[model samples]
Target: MPVQVSPERFDEIVGEALDLIPEELAARMENVAVLTADAPSPTQRRGRTGRSLLGLYEGVNLTRRSPVRYSAVMPDRITIFRLSHCRIVRDEDELRRRVARTVAHEIAHHFGISDDRLRELGAY
Candidate 1:
């Protein structure tokens, strides 16, 4: 039988991954909202290839040398797609691993790590 997964279980897995982030790095992140969606929203699907991005990190690049915005709102963040991820993986363990990897990938973006660098680091 195919392995079944629940969003609650996925949320628990994400929590575990969040706990794994380095403390110093985690400190730099604020307002990390761990949202789980079945698929990319229309807005998320806009302006890109029709294929959906598994996770997204919306924040300022750390490498940029500009004054920080005073909007008081830290950059919004880290949304994971549950259904999309599960469809590509075979079992629960694989699903958990993918969740952890995707979490790291988005966190890398928070630290201004480029996608290429993230791939090189095996976070993708």
Candidate 2:
């Protein structure tokens, strides 16, 4: 039976998913931030209307090189939407799985994985 899960439960699940990331993959992740938001931006509109986006990874890809090193690293953000996830997930278990998948999708982008490759790996 599917039990109703709260926001706190989803947060905890996302946390656990973060913990499960392989050390090598997790190590390459630097200054990467994960957050939960209610929705996407005006620029993100592609005809779909929703209160939240399942996840978002906003950061500079490795292909873009910086000539100078700064004192502080730039912020790399990954936003996960709770309500969006809940819409597709029937229970806590599925939600956690989806969260883990979303994390991998964004993290892969950060790690320089191409969109085609990501799709092949089932990250999309």
Candidate 3:
């Protein structure tokens, strides 16, 4: 069965996961906003129907930025799908680990790491 948690508690878990990030990396994470949502919206889902997304990172990654062209842009968005996480875990410990892993995964995108690279690194 899915282990459910209150939204407030879930938010706390996300915060805790973020806090675990190294300070140097966190400091370099400029103009990014991390958010939590119940689930991804339909548009966000696009045409993928077979899998549920645990998180999403939307915006230009560090490697794609140029000092002249990157000015005055909107903040990068990293959204954690709270409901998806809650639906997959069996208990609080699993939930915490999953959330932490998801957060790290999304943050890696911000730093210009691809899913393929993550898999190569045994991070996935």
Give the RMSD in angstroms, all C-alphas superposed, for model 2. Answer: 3.4
Off by over 4 Å in 2: 1-4, 41-52, 67-73
lDDT of 2 by residue, 2-77 (tens): 4456767767877888898999878877777877655566664466565456777777755553646522667788
TM-score-superior candidate, 2 or 3? 3
Q: In candidate 3, how many Å is residue 38 off?
A: 0.2
How many residue pairs clash per model?
A: 0, 0, 0
Taken over the whole model, the C-alpha lDDT of each candidate is 0.75, 0.72, 0.94
Q: Candidate 3, which segments miss by more than 4 Å at Cα? A: none
How do the predictions measure up, each by TM-score?
A: 0.81, 0.77, 0.96
Which structure is stronger by TM-score: 1 or 3? 3
Worst 10 residues of 1 by lDDT: 62-71
Clashing pairs in 3: none
Alpha-carbon shift of residue 19 in model 1 (angstroms): 1.4
Cα lDDT for residue 61, candidate 3: 95
| RMSD of each candidate relative to the true structure | 2.5, 3.4, 0.9
